[model samples]
Target chain A: MQGATVATYDFIFNGLGLREWCGESVRSGPMTMADLLARGAAPAEPQTGFDWGALWSLPFPSLDELHKACAEIPRSRDLTRSLEAGFLNVRESLRFVLDPMTQPLSWALENALHVAVNTPWWLMLMALLVVVWLAGRSAALVGLVAAVMGFLLFVDHYVFAMQTLSIIFVCAFLCVVMGVPVGIAMSRSNRFQRLMIPVLDMLQTLPTFVYLIPLIFLFSVTEPKLYGIAIILYAIVPVIRLTDLGIRLVDKEVIEAAEAFGMTRHQKLIRVQIPLALPNIMAGVNQTIMMSLAMVVIASLVSAPGLGVLVLRGIRNLELGVGLMAGLGIVLLAVILDRVTKAALARVNAAASVARH
Target chain B: MMDRQVSIAIRHLYKIFGANPVRALEHVRAGTGKDALMAQHRHVLGLRDINIDMRAGDITVVMGLSGSGKSTLIRHVNRLIEPTAGEILVNGENILEFGETRLRELRRKQMSMVFQHFALLPHRTVLDNIGLARSVRGERRADFERDALHWLARVGLGGQEGQYPHQLSGGMQQRVGIARALTSNAPIMLMDEAFSALDPLIRTDMQDLLLELQTELQKTIIFISHDLDEALKLADHLVILKDGSVVQQGEPQEILLKPNDPYIVDFISDINRARVLRVRSVMDRAPETIPQVAGTVDVDATLESVIALSGGDTALSYAVRNRDTTVGYLNMQSLVRALVPTQAPRHGNRKQEKAQPAASGPAA
Candidate 1:
């Protein structure tokens, strides 16, 4: 029975049924012997024993059954094709965001927002000092900040730098505040970790320019919060990823020891697990800050201020002096931020040690 | 003599890891055993039907190879791994019923454990690490440090307070671990193969230190080791486990004299029984009078020590005194008989023949 079914299937697949539907005229629909002579097709071999009745009267599936049987094949194939297309679309969108092809609207929006914020020169200098203070408490950091502020003042780009600093501070703070809990939640639940990991990976690898495209569609350049939102989206991924990693990497034995000591889950988390995991979390925070700084420069393309304007100015008019000084100021700010947060992390870990003792 | 003095009592405890622990445990209780349970669910019976008692001021050594559930057994005492079925009574109180706070309090005040690997907090100084248990109990820093320093000195780690665990030798690290446990002042100390990771020389030193400490503190101790020699040396009572079941449990001398089963006999076969055995094994009644001697050996000294003092003299004799009274004499014949090389039969027989003649006469 299986063999008979296979024969019918082969017949249908080879278009033998189409020939039958065309009717028995034309010598039973193109015999191998006649076709070989007429059209030089392959020569036919003689059959020793032919079961013509068995061949013709075999039970075969109806057209509806065939359609039903083969239906899932195309459906699965289409699903695979669509999935590939979706992945391509995602990749393309990310590429577009990272480095957009269209420059004029981006440039115009950047300039309009910059003019509207128009932060005062003194406020910008103060913001720079605050950035320096928050990042590092060292005299070296303070001195570096003072010198950069003085140079910014000397160059008359103080207002732009402060506008940039304010946006970065707010965005980075929001990222840490929001990302850490989400990361913790992700670490706690396997289902949540599985679901969030891919999304975080996509966010991390997505092009920065692609992020602006969605925001550009959602909010106009005139809004003060536009750059703020953009900066947060671009920089939030590092902290989320790092926080998840940190909590997951906490030693199982330590946690078990804490539990053995009769610590409540919350108490263990607060007193033992998190304290032990703090170094990694702080390292994550440091990465988040660095990433925020990196995005601040790109945020400048959208009218977010700071050293980015000097860079933009350098690019547009080929003014090397303005760009070089601003670049130096940004580096100084980055160093100050990196050092201060790291020092704070070190202090926290030290305090945790003291408490553990 | 009070049964109520039993510090920890574990009865038929079962720990099976799976979503269906009861079913797994029931399977075990029903004689399906570990293999059947593992077939249904990829679960292991880490501990199975474990019944034991750790008494006050006695060190019960749980001797087993790796995966025989020695560590698991110790962990269950503190409820680190909750037993599936059975009661764990610590000081007449079933700890299975202890809530988080009470359990924490029990761990803080009643029990302290030392791991084989010496699980010292890596980032903290020796002083801070030793003081951690006190701080966890909410003691003030100065008081905790003072106590930590005292305990550190007790463990022979004085003046090493400022150093980190990494700076210490393996033996010193374990000493710090002991000090940390001591600083907690917990009545029961669970030492899980505490000296198993140290060198032989260091291990012997640490064992001696533990014996000295135990003499003074009289802390209830549950020590785990796979080494029979170690168990024989330190344990007043010995519990041998195999495949998560108790093979034997008795006083060390009792186990050595007559092991309950061949498994235990094989386990302790390599042990130097004569060295580990007591004076009761080879004692002889005193003659009417024993000759006075300048030096006297303790009755508890091993035959090896007796041989060392006899100086290869076939006719040597010693005066054995208990306090002021001369209890007896130990003849060189007995000492030679005990210490003669067991492997060389000809030499052993020659020594035995030579010593028999000396035994017929008393010393001047």
Candidate 2:
């Protein structure tokens, strides 16, 4: 094993079947069929190789290495194939059980979206404007939102934007609903935190498209749930991390003080801890909503009708105006959501400080 | 105020703070010292075989330095910390065996504790924090608000009921803590360094106010303090601890006159002895022939007052009165002896609870 080096080609330049192709230049990149979708077609290779001096040589002197490789053969395909199979098994059996439990959320989101899209554009605009005005308590911010909505309407992207928005609102709502309790459980128990941290890490760092890929295989793209679950998994991380942090950050003295008063665990949590942690939780919700909007655009790849579909269509068809206009609509929605939530957060902070007083 | 009788008895209590304290306790029980337990066995001896009988309607102050387990002992009374081995009997029923529900019931209905930091719920208004015990017992806010308001007024924070804790100054915050405890109307009150967080002047005022309230309400109070001056002024029965063991405990005046431990001697060395010494500490039992008194001096009168009255006359003697009748006779020489801590450890002869004995002072 000490003098293990072999031919020059085998050591430094193995795994390349050809010397080079097109303008490849030996810099590895996306070379799949999807790359052809972005570009018109794969450029033809004009190279005829007379450079086979080092190309055909191969190393074949390692039985132990071959055995080690053979042992991993079953797990080699898909890299994490066993994990994939395990998750798929759970999804198949668990989906039916979960759908009943999660039906209310799906029902609520579906009804909400139905109302948001089916209502007259003017009435929807008025409702949103009123809500924004109430939250921000600033007529100027409301007017800015109205003007953005007005511009979106003139551009005829209002309905698509609204569709995108409704999806985000629902996903963000569900993220908070589920995330807060999980975060609380994490903060309350070290064992729960140890269990959740890796899963949360996967949810955060695993490719966003990978989340949709599994759902696509498990459920048809036609079912809203496929994208719904994908969006939730993609967007739920911030709220969970922040909510856990918020609870964990509460002053220890305050907790001891509460316990001393003979407040039961539930009473202490509700009456003391949560109110103090509200601002942090609100910030978490804000990040969740923003992330939800981001995922909504990506989710359109799987039959989720929204401004994201338009963005995808523009990408597919090379229509710059179409893509830019839809992207602009997403930006406007983001601004509105961000401002309203932030204003509400500031108000919560004020009230919290007052209570602290 | 009602005359105090024995209410809470903490007997053979041991608190060892460590994982596997039950196992480490064998070493502790087999004559291991606190240092040996910590350095050799990796266990902190929080309290060791502590015994104290807290009298009803009296301020039984427990004093110790930091890490002396004074706080630990006080917390044990409320069962905030489960003792490794011990008995805490509140009204003669062992609390060590209490289930969670019974313990909570004891906490909410029988005893209320005031904390060093006041322990006011920052989220609650003054009224709400004051009504916490009642609220814990499932009483509606309306049902307790009147009592809460009454205590608020009593503590001189009447109109501040609507205000939050942070709106008040530190002194005001502790007043609310007092009101919260008193409003609970629990028979026993435990105060752990309740005024230690206050400034010295505010501390004196707070102590005075506590004594004033105790005179009327006479609730059994178990107070924990590190300050010798505070203990001497406020304690009816003072228990001194060192390294989780009782060094000496009895009446503060008697303990001051005759410190049993060298540690206790060093502790009281810096105290203003004349200000703390009272006539009851120095006086002998009244002679069968009542003395020709210089004048009637209350048993509770500080030696400073006697010194001022007699103008350093060594020949004078006075009959020491408890309420209106003579129970003991005070001499100037005895007063001087009482002012100084004795060098020799007095063995098995200390009895200060006998002063107001045999005849109950005119019934309240």
Candidate 3:
């Protein structure tokens, strides 16, 4: 309190009357040895030693730290606390609007997890191979998927790997389903794209922990949607951004040709823009899958089930073997997904360029 | 073969590209120049007071350098780019007042366009691209396949129909574009620099193909180009633009013989005039008594062929025949004189020049 001083910023903010929200009151006097001794009646030993080597120190609470300890100016921490409070104040309203809208997402994640875990390992492997074949049309990629699944099975991490994958599958699918139309809407309108870019930039650049803090307050930890929502929010950005970019980047001459041929906006979008943009969209999907895997592991901090759970347990119990094995399992799963999607992307690229020749 | 009339008539068409086009239109109407309008008001005057009557069953070529707004003018006929102010009449109907549904109907059923870049859809096969306008109208492939294939064969792309656009050379791709336009069966075809992207030999071939098609189809085609030779070859009526305004427009031969602007003089300066000027243009109409002639040449024969016919003899004269009917007499001397470019009248000398212009004409 004795160190409190009214700086110019404090005077300005005090004139603005922001003290009630964040400011502390100023004390009556500055500190001195005489005042300390008079108040406590303690005897002091005087040392008349002077240090000549002293450099000129800055005044207390220099301009750089003016807002740190001022009475009238709001501190950085207080400003952030108020921001959190403002968001919390609307939490009930936000939940009321978002809960029923998002309850299906929880069910989708839960059912997918349940179905994946209960399916016989061989059947799941067969189905995964079929999906891989369908996406890639490459026998080598299909065999790669089979080998990765076999390795995970042999390591006894099959169930945990399935859990992580099932969650990723549901989330990434939902991201594409929801993100593409939003990206289309953005590409069609300049104002919408302008409005969405900052939002997308913030979603991409914000720390994973910052958003998780609010989600934890908004939903119960036990809710499957807590992590599903987290994974979706973190992974959906690339797909949306790339979809918009892809559509916008279609050849202007082609677009003009479409218009000159009297194509309706919808007809042009469906028949021309989307077909041409498919390769870029597929690349976005690949990035989204990779991002979903990354976010799922981080989401394990909030009780998201998967190999991440084993990794968490290993960390808590200090079992290096458990941690390393789970880590290897996640890495293998990531490689499988990455290679499969990349193979599919290559197929799309080839088809697109085949005609370009 | 068919009655020719005005197909697309653009009147006082003005297009200013900027945030406030209406305000800029005021400056344009006040006769503010294109560059000045840009410098003073930050608005691009894309087109200014363009009035041209594109005739039915004839190719009206709009020729200009890039940014002279020839492209902009063509787009306006299709309403691809809207005008800041104007009237566009197709078959005497003002298209500028048409609603979106009516405009779409007009575009879908009455007009189709060819592009400079041969903008065939890369994803679609050549046949599919040819059938695009019909497909956009929700027509089944079976419904248009016969007609589309007919045009495909007509454009000499029959076997290549299954190939993509990129598989075709630039000339071949534009042939596909032409086939697509023909398959639409629209009477009005807008070609925006259609043959400009082809090689010289291919361009000549395309020009011949277009002429051959025009003789058969007789559609009202509006062609845009920057090349004077192509314009002379293809244009039934030539409209030349400069700085977003029409410098002069008329029969190509008439414009060549009587260029009204210095800009046009410069544009036609380097042209091989002997190849483009015609016997009919430099001939005297219905002489009282037929003069001694080296030969009779077709009314449409180029002066170059006529020169070769007379062996460059200045004393030789030829009778001009229009389909076996003697229409005029072309003196080789006047033909040689017509080969010389017309002098562009400079400022303050126009009135004096106009008083003496009867001597400079090709009429003997």
The DockQ-derived docking category for candidate 3 is acceptable
Better of 2 and 3 by DockQ: 3
* Model 2 agreement with the true structure over B154-238: per-residue lDDT tens digits: 9888899998888899999999999989988998998989999999999999999999999999899999999999999999899
| DockQ of all predictions against the true structure, Cα-based | 0.17, 0.29, 0.48
Instruction: Let me know the DockQ for model 3.
Output: 0.48
In angstroms, the error of model 3 at A113 is 1.4
lDDT of 3: 0.86
- lDDT per residue for candidate 1 within A311-345, as digits (tens), equals 98998999998888778778866876787788778
Q: RMSD for all candidates, in order, please.
A: 12.2, 9.7, 6.0
Which consecutive 10 residues in model 1 chain A have the weakest lDDT in total? A1-10
Could you tell me the interface RMSD of model 1? Answer: 5.7
Model with the higher lDDT, candidate 2 or 3: 3
lDDT of 3 by residue, A203-296 (tens): 9999988779989988989999999999999899999999999999887878887887788999999988988888889888999999999989
The residue pairs that clash in candidate 2, if any, are A357-B166, A357-B167
For model 2, the local distance difference test gives 0.81
**Candidate 3: deviation at residue A19, Å?**
12
The candidate that achieves the highest TM-score relative to the unseen native structure: 3
Report the C-alpha lDDT of model 3 over B255-303, residue by residue, as the tens digit: 9999876567767877899999988888999777778987899999999
Q: List the residue pairs that clash in candidate 1.
A: A97-A209, A97-A210, A135-A340, A136-A340, A160-A306, A161-A306
